[model samples]
Target chain A: MHGLVNRAIQSFVTDTYGPDRWRRVTEAAELGDFEFEAMLIYDDAVTEALLAAFCADLGRSRGEVLEDLGTYLVSHPSVEALRRLLRFGGDSYVDFLHSLDDLNDRARLAVPDLHLPALDLREEGAGRYTLACGPGMPGFGWVMMGILRAMADDYGALVLLEHHGPHADEGADDEADEVIAVTLIESAFAAGRAFDLGARAG
Target chain B: MIAEDTLAGILARLCPMHLLVDDSGVIRRVGPTLQKLRPETPMPGQRFLDLFDLTRPRKVGCFADLLTGEGKLGVAFRDAPHTALKGQIVPLPGGAVIDLSFGISLIDAVRDYALTSADFAATSLAIELLYLVEAKSAVMGEYGQLSRRLQTARISAEEQAFTDTLTGLKNRRAMDHVLTRKAASGMPYSVMHIDLDFFKQVNDSLGHAAGDHVLQQVARILVEETRQEDTVARVGGDEFVIVFDNLTDRPRLRRIAERLIDRLQQPMLFQGRPCAISASIGIAPSVEQPLVSPAGLLRLADLALYDAKHAGRSTLRFATPRPAEPAWTRPAAGKDGETAPPSAVSGRDS
Candidate 1:
């Protein structure tokens, strides 16, 4: 796993739960004095161990924790760069939803070595979409659902989202594609946050 | 064939910035999107050439020239914001239809006109271009942060490597590097080797803590007695070396050595017990021997220190100048003949 991902997780935990709680989690995982460097690479097992320990310490399910991570990423002040990057997708909520299909390619352009799961957005009808997350990290659909809910709010649109676990035909393996169903109820529920093409203030 | 009324509606929906001109070069109609660029509506009597300046296909003086241009044409509104547009012209029976889009000025156009996604065609790649620009900014931000972190880490690591943990002075490796540069720099200098006297007795009688405290005191005295241009280094457990820059005067070097020895002889109290220690210093001035390498000079100082230790432990000694080697004793090797093993030295007072 790329260290940026792990560092994000560390930042999410420390920023939300406090450094003391993060220390306990690392201790419980038997990681003696470990710190994630943003530019280095780590074994995949390190991520698994960290997640398992975090889940055990908080008594929360893995999917729930990961979903909250996705929400924190888009809405937190510490990660405002991420919000600005995604807001460039479109001007309207519906336009942003259609732009999800190209999310993987766009992410690759920023950090070439970072590998995100492939995103395929399919429209079922008016204001209804199904986003299929290709096989990669497990429980990634929950994370996408969290991002969708936050972005909809950012655009001042009322939206409903449901995370459908991987298909049962894939036998509960990590290889099965997960899905998130979205229904945008109202595009202009209220005035949205202002955005400008020129990111910096003159 | 399509009716003129229906054709206008289709063009309005497809290209909101389109314009329809009459055979006399008078503007008959303007698309809804282009109408938003100006305040006045119903511009039916305005001449096409009067409203816009032909920037590309520069010879277009009349309506006939619009039909003869081959590739994409460029035009700018002769008003505030001066929005530039690029498009193609399709000739009709009586006039020409001109459909245009903002070329590279999309950012300023979007900002100035307050345009939204609905104003553009659904198939336009403008959204993709916007995404690319934002992505580049975000990536560059993080790239700059990464560069700063890498630079800070490199400088910190280098400082740590050259510092001694015990006395906070430059270590042996740093001394070797600096001395090598100084020796090759074609400048007269001096090297002094200092050894702590009865330091081992402090640890033997008291504890290693007292020995450590005494060594730190010795380091402080050495630093206090030398100028800032001199390099003071802890080269061993109880040994230190200083390279004095551009100072080869023998009497001044001896005075510095005596002052350092007098200061180090003071008893320092560690845990309320006075730990007595002294220092023996030996100096080699480059004026005495001009052709020695840094390593050879250090060895000469070491030999003088040996003489001081034998002449009653706490005194200072100066290395005597060497006699010229006999021609028969010179090596036949080329270029490095002077780098031979230094002969024995007899320390003497200046």
Candidate 2:
């Protein structure tokens, strides 16, 4: 994983929790100093240990933690540049969903060594989409679901997201290949209006 | 459905600022955010390269050059002199879109652009790294201070241990160390063993406080008469030893001892009462026998001192080599019942 990915997790913990909490998590992980550089490469075991420690400290499952990280990446102002990059994909909610398939290519332009899991999007009905993620990342499908929900809020589209276990059909061999189904209940652009009105009232 | 203008407004809000440039590097469109960042409104026909200078991606020369480049580049706008912006330039069909975000120092960016922590990406770890460096520096500074204090205390303790409390001269222990060192060097040297003529009389008549005053004054006289390289130490009550190094000439050594005796004979006030005291000095020259140990040298000097005391006091004597006789043997009395000089007594004993 790129340093950017680890940094995002660190920021997710610090911003949502506090620096003290992050310190305790690192201590529980038996990591010393926990110094990280933006462009430096680190062992994959370090990230795994930190995540495991975080899961234990927070008493949450790994999937839930990753989902929270995904939500934080979009909502936090610290990741405003990344949110802008993701928003540049398209104008509408469905356009953004389709652009997910080429996200890794776009990300590679910024970081040459970045290797994100491949995503496949297919339109099933008028307002429904089927998304499949590659097996390269485990338990990351939940993070993708969180990102989709946040993107839906950004686009002012009401969506119903569901996760069916990897083998929805008899032909599926491994759990690494899983598909998520998304249904759009309303595209009224009402959420953005409410947010803007709240901002104005404040 | 969202209108095109509304979507563009949303995009502009997400970006720091953006500029649309033609193939000729002329500004074609300016986002509303860009208008707010600049002091003057940008004209559509103006050249984009003339308005902003590229700072990062050092290889990129102009706006046209950035169209062929990858990754983000830093830019400094002439209109906003103090602020630096960073982002990417994406090539379009006939032109390029330059998207800029503030890229100055974090402290300055926060203050100047009114940006909050939310404006920064969580991927940036430079802030936390700087904090750790500062914390480590503070700890090192504290440790350095403590080390310096400990060194000062050790030096003070060593000085106190080797100094005489009353006379402010080197004590017996310090003299022992110096004599041992000099003896090991096998250099020609001389030792003067001095005893006050009537130190006990001053203490019995005027009390020990006046005795202490006289002793301090005597120490000052001895230090003043001797050369800087000599070592003056208080070895016992009313007894002092001076070690003069690297001197072998007898006439010069005798002159120094005579001057010390003359100075001690001068009258000095002790508690507002005139008091007079003299010193009996014994010289032990090491020119002929430089290999003598410190203890052997002290015993020879003491024998010479006994000779000086028997010669009716307030006089000086030099130790002569006596191969067959021990230093502790006392000189014999004169035929008339008075103690004879060292040479006369040695002759009588032989």
Candidate 3:
């Protein structure tokens, strides 16, 4: 796993659950006193160990923790720069949803080595869309659900989101894709949070 | 087969900045967008030629000349803040119809007039262009951030490559580059070669860690005895080289070398155990024999270092001028003591 991904998880845990909790988790995972360096690469097993530790300590499933991590990434003040980059997708919630297909490509422009999950959004009918999250680590669909729910609120749109975990249908084990179905109830249900094209000087 | 009134309505919807004039060159009507540009200015009922000055079709002076104008027309308001527009003109039975758009000034016009996508014709690509501009800005902002991060990483990597991790001094590679540059510069300088006297014994008696602590202390002492313009490098485990820029005075060089030897002779404590060490120095002042290559200079200093070691450890020596042959072919120490002081190495250039 990229150290940036691990660092993000570390920051999410440390900021939301307190530094003492984070220290206990790292100790439980046997990570020693070293912190993840953003520019370095680490073993994928390190991330698995961290997730397992979080689940064991908090008594919560890995999916629930990852979903909350997704929400914190978009809504946390420390990661406001990420929110600004995402807001450039478009003016409306519908436009932002359509831009997901290009999100991986756009992210690669900044960090060429980062591997974000590939997304395919298919419009089934008016206001109804099915998003296919490519096979990767488990629970990424739940993360996308959390991000979509938060973004819908950011755009003041009422939306119904459902995450369908990896499943095999008709005795074929190849259907490993995690999917999320979105039903946009109202594009402009209320006045959205104000956004500016340029960052204002403090 | 379209009625005149319906044609007027269609023109209004298609080109909101269109203008129509009668046969006498009187303004019959102005498009809704053009009127919004300056709401205080009454445009209709005025002479069409008086309201706008045709910038394109250079010699156009009246409506008749404009009809003969072959290419695209360019016009601007005749009043303050003369907003320019580019369009085409079509001649009717009595007058002419002129349809204008903001051209390249669309962004500024949108900001100045508070115009929206609804104000433009449905077929226009203005909305798409606006989206592209927004996307370009966002990508450029992220690109700038990436550039800054890469620049910082490059500088830190370069620093690490040229620095000795143990002593925190310039390593052999960095010293080689500096020596080459200084030798090529035609300025007289001095090269001082230093070797710790008891560094090996310290490592054997105490440990490698204690030897490291002693070397780091020796590095600090050497740096303190040299000027900021001089470079002190750790060329080997117990060997260092100092290039004194433009200093050839033997008396001052001897004093600095003595001070370095005195400092290195001090005992350093590591893990509460005292470890003692000393240094031997050899100086090759270029003013004695000028224009030597960097490698040749180091050879001369090495010869002097050999002589100092023979004279007993923790001492200093100066390299005597070489024969006209070259410093590279000069004989090493222990060959003969014929060049000892008061006999042969006593000649001063000035």
What DockQ was computed for model 2? 0.02
TM-score of each: 0.63, 0.38, 0.51
Cand. 2 TM to true fold: 0.38
Tell how far residue A109 is off in model 2, in angstroms: 1.3
Best by lDDT: 1
True contacts kept of 3: 0.00
DockQ of 1: 0.21
Instruction: Report residue B10 deviation for candidate 2 (angstroms).
Output: 27
Candidate 2 at residue B112, lDDT?
Answer: 54
| Model 2 alpha-carbon miss at residue B292, Å | 24
Candidate 2 residue pairs in clash (backbone atoms < 3 Å): A77-B118, A78-B118, A78-B120, A78-B121
Query: How well does chain B match by TM-score in each candidate?
Result: 0.50, 0.49, 0.50
Each prediction's Cα lDDT score?
Answer: 0.79, 0.71, 0.77
What shift in Å separates residue A125 of candidate 1 from its native position after superposition?
A: 4.8
- Model 1 in CAPRI terms: which quality? incorrect
Model 2: share of real contacts kept: 0.00
Give me the candidate number with maximum TM-score. 1
List the pairs of residues colliding in candidate 3. Answer: none
Give lDDT tens digits, candidate 1, residues B69-93: 6846888888767899888888888
Q: Compared with the true structure, what per-residue lDDT tens digits does model 2 show for residues B122-173?
A: 3343333322333344334435665776699788886768778899888888
Q: What is the lDDT of residue B277 in candidate 3?
A: 84
